[model samples]
Target: MKLQGTMLVKENELYIGGVSCKELREKYQTPLYVFDEDLVRNNCREYVKHFRVNKENNRVAYAGKAFLPIYMCKLINEEGLCLDVVSGGELYTAYKAQFPMEKILFHGNNKTIEEIKMGVELGVGRFVVDNYYELELLEKICEEKGEKQAVYFRITPGIEAHTHEYIKTGQIDSKFGFTLSNGELYNALEKLNNYKNIELVGIHAHIGSQIFEVEPYLDEVKIMMNLVKEIKESYNIDIKEVDLGGGMGVYYTEEDKPKTIKKFCEAIIEKTEEVCKKIDIKVPILIIEPGRSIVANGGSTIYTVGAMKHIKGIRTYVSVDGGMTDNIRPSLYQAGYECAIANKIGEKRKNQVTISGKCCESGDILITDTNIMDIKSGDILIISSTGAYGYSMASNYNKITKPAVVSVQNGKSKLICKRQSYEDLFKLEVV
Candidate 1:
C-alpha cells in the first residue's frame, strides 16, 4: 500500500504524522479516521495557490459535502478558503464554527424553506439555484426580506462525463440542473431577468466526482463559455462569475492515475483564457468547488482485524472490526481502496485476501482480491484515500457506533470528532 501524507516506516511499523498506527489502534481503538492536519492544510493552500489565475476574480471554495464537522469547517475558515455547503446541517456546522457567512455558498437540489430563510437572514454569499421551484422560492424569500440574493443558475451542459452513474450530475437527463437542450436553461435565464430580488451573477456546472480525465473539464469550460456568449447576446447581461463546479478525482489505488492540481489548474486556465479571448468576453470569477481531490488522500482509516474465514478452492476473507458502517464506498458505488497491515508492514506479501467488515450483511466487503501481507487477529489494517466520504457518509448500520476522528501533526494527536457512544444512537429516540 502507498504511504500517504506523514506516513513513514519507523522500526518497520507504520507511523502517520509521528503517531504510530499500532499505538493509535490501542489508544483510540479500531475503525478510526485519522487525518494529518499539516497535510490537509497544505492541500487547501495548494488548491488556493494553483487555482488563483486571477487574484481579483478567482477563489477556491472547499466543498463541505466531502467532509464537514465543526472542526473541519473551522480549519477551512482558517485557511481563508470559501465554503460550499449543500444542506442545513452543513450550514449549521459552519454557523457554529463561526465561519464567515459571506463566504459560504449554499447549494442543494431541494433546499428547505427554513434553510432558505436562514441563508437570507445570515447573508450567505451565493446560492447555486437548481430548479424553478427553488429559484422562485428564493426570490420570494429575498423579496419578503427586502434583500437581494446573488445566485448562479446551474446548467446541465449535456456532457456525458465518464464516471459512475450515481455521481454524474452534468448529464442532460440528470435531475440536478436545468438542461440546455430542453429550453429550460434559456427559460431560467429569461425569468431571472425579472427577479427583482435576485442578482444573477454567474453560472455553475459540475460534471461528476472521482473523474480521472482533464478533457472533461476542458469540455465543460468550452461549453460554459459558449453559453455565456449566447446569454450575453440574448439577455444583454454580463456574468461576473463562471463557476465550473469542482469534481477532480484523486488517487485511490495504483490503478487510478489522477492529474496533479498544478496540471489541472494549467489545463483549466489555458482553456478558459483561450475561449474567453476567442469570444471577446472578459474573464469572470473562475470558481471550482473541489472536495475529494483536496481531502481524500490526506486522510486514512485504521481498522483491527477480527476474523479470518477461508473456504476450499475459494477466496480468503479477512474481517475487520469496522465495515460499511465506517467506510461504505465499496458497498455504495463499488469504490476501490488500498490497505496494508500497519502493525507488520514488511511481512511477506504471499497472501491474497478479501477484506470484509464486521457488519452482518454479506455485501459489506471493503476490498476483494487484494494482495497484502499475512493478516492475523489484533493486527491494524490501514485503508488509504478514505478522507473524503468515509466518515462523512458513515452510518449506524446494525447499531454500530461511528468511530472517532483525530487530527495528527508533528507526532501528536488531537481529537476532533469524538467517538459516538451507544446513547448517541438513541439520542433522538423515545421509549
Candidate 2:
C-alpha cells in the first residue's frame, strides 16, 4: 500500500501531521505508536460521504477491538460514528469517554451475566446476540430489569472468504455465530419468538478480515436476503436492521489491492437493493463495523534498531528493543509489513537483512527478508499499516513493557496513552 495522508516523511524526518517522529520518540521513548488524528477523521468522513450519496439508512460503527482509547472513542463520537464494543472493559472505556450509551452496540461471543446486566442497565442501542446462551442471559436480564432490550441475532452465513483461517470468523465450522447450514437459524427465530423481554429486531453476519474481494460479501448478502425472506414468511416478522459486519481489507504491502470505502459500501448497497427488490422486502438499515480499514493505515509504530549481527553467509539479524510483545501480527498470522528508515527515507536499499525482536524465542523475527540500505545501531525504523492491531494485541511477554501511543494533528503531537512501566506491570500481579 502506498503511504498517503499525514503519516509520511517530510524534510528527511518521519512526520505525522507535520510533527517529527524523532522528537516524539525522544519525548515518549522507543517503541511508540503515533497516530495522525486528521487521517482518522478523514477516514470516517469518507465512509460517511459514501453512505450518504444515495440517502441510504446506514450507520458506521467503529470497531473498538481494533484500537480503543478514550481519545479515539471521543474522536469517533465527534465524527458521528457509532461505537462497537466487544467486552465490558471496552464498554466501560466508551462510557468513561462519555460516548452516548444509546449509540453503543455491544457485541461478543460469550458475554458474562454481569456484562448483560450492565448493558441492559445502561440501555445500549443494541446487542448482537451471538449464541442461544447469550439470548437466554439477555432474556433473564431484561425480564429482571423490566425493560425490553433490542437485539440482533448473529448468524453464520456459511460463506467463508479467502483469508487467514485464524481471522476468518463467518465460516460454518467457526465457534462464533449459529451456522445456517443445519436449520439452526430457523430454530433460533422460533426461540426468539417466545421471548417477550428481548426484542429481536435484526440479523448480523461478519465474514472475515483483510478480504480484498467483494464477491464473498455479495454472496453473504444473497444468503442474508433469502434468510430475511424466510423469517418474514415463517414467523411473520419484519426485520428492522441488517448488520453486515466489517471485513473490508486495507493495504498492508505492495501486493494488497483494497477497494475504497465508498466503492465497497456502494457495491453492498446495490446488492442489497437488488435482493430486496427480488424478495419484495424493504431494505433494512445498513450497519457496518469497520475496525481495521478505518485505522490500519492511520498509525505507525517506531522502533530503534539496537544490535546488528552478520553470521557470514547465513543471514543478517537486526534486532530492535521491542519485538513480538508490541506487534504480534507477524508471528501470529505470518503478516507482512513494510518499513523505512525514519531519517533516510530516500536512501538506496543495498543491504538484505531480517528484522528481529529482542526476545528469547527463535520465532521473534519481525520481517523475514527486507531490502534496505545500510543499517546501524540507534537508527529509527518505522513500520507501516500497524494502527489497527499493533497496540491492541500488545503483551507483557519477556517482562517487556508496552509502548506508548501519541496523536499527531496539525503539526502538534500529544500523548494519548502512556507507556507501561515496571511498576505498572506488577500492579496486577498477586503474591
Q: Each prediction's Cα lDDT score? A: 0.90, 0.88
Off by over 4 Å in 2: none
Q: Give the per-residue lDDT digits (tens) of candidate 2, residues 317-345.
A: 99988889999999998999888788777
| Model 1 CA deviation exceeding 4 Å by range | 53-56
The candidate scoring highest on lDDT is: 1
* Model 1 Cα lDDT, one tens digit per residue, 75-95: 988887899999888988899
Best-matching candidate per TM-score: 1
**Candidate 2: worst-modelled 10 consecutive residues by lDDT:** 48-57
